[model samples]
Target: VKSQHSERCIDFLTKELKVSNEKQAQERVLFVSARETLQAR
Candidate 1:
């Protein structure tokens, strides 16, 4: 069973955040993760 907000972050990114398609969606996650990784050093 999926929660009410299941995959909601993806929705926000694609809708309100205007991320467009899957490639753009994945890229956004990767970029943010990389930024966090660098900051943790």
Candidate 2:
């Protein structure tokens, strides 16, 4: 039972990490595009 609980915790943490990474990637894309737009003006 203890092992099973730890496995679930690890899984949850991995999922949370993946979500944060995706958010960071999205923010980077947005920043790059905004910079490009500013340069174009």
- Using TM-score, give the best candidate's number: 2
Q: What TM-score does each of the candidates earn?
A: 0.34, 0.36
lDDT string, candidate 2, 1-41, tens digits: 54565455455545655544434444333212556679999
Candidate 2, residue 5: how far the Cα is off, in Å = 0.3
User: Can you tell me which runs of candidate 1 are displaced by over 4 Å?
Assistant: 1-6, 23-41
- How many angstroms is residue 21 displaced in model 2 relative to the true structure, after the best TM-score fit? 11
Per-residue C-alpha lDDT of model 1 across residues 1-41, encoded as one tens digit per residue: 13323356557778887857656755554323556679999
Q: Any runs in candidate 2 off by more than 4 Å, and if so which? A: 16-41
The local lDDT score (0 to 100) that residue 37 gets in candidate 2 is 77
RMSD of each: 6.7, 14.9
Instruction: Give Cα-based local distance difference scores for all models.
Output: 0.57, 0.48
Q: Give me the displacement of residue 17 in model 2, in angstroms.
A: 4.6
Clashes of 2: 0
lDDT of 2 at 2: 43
Q: What is the TM-score (0 to 1) of candidate 2? A: 0.36
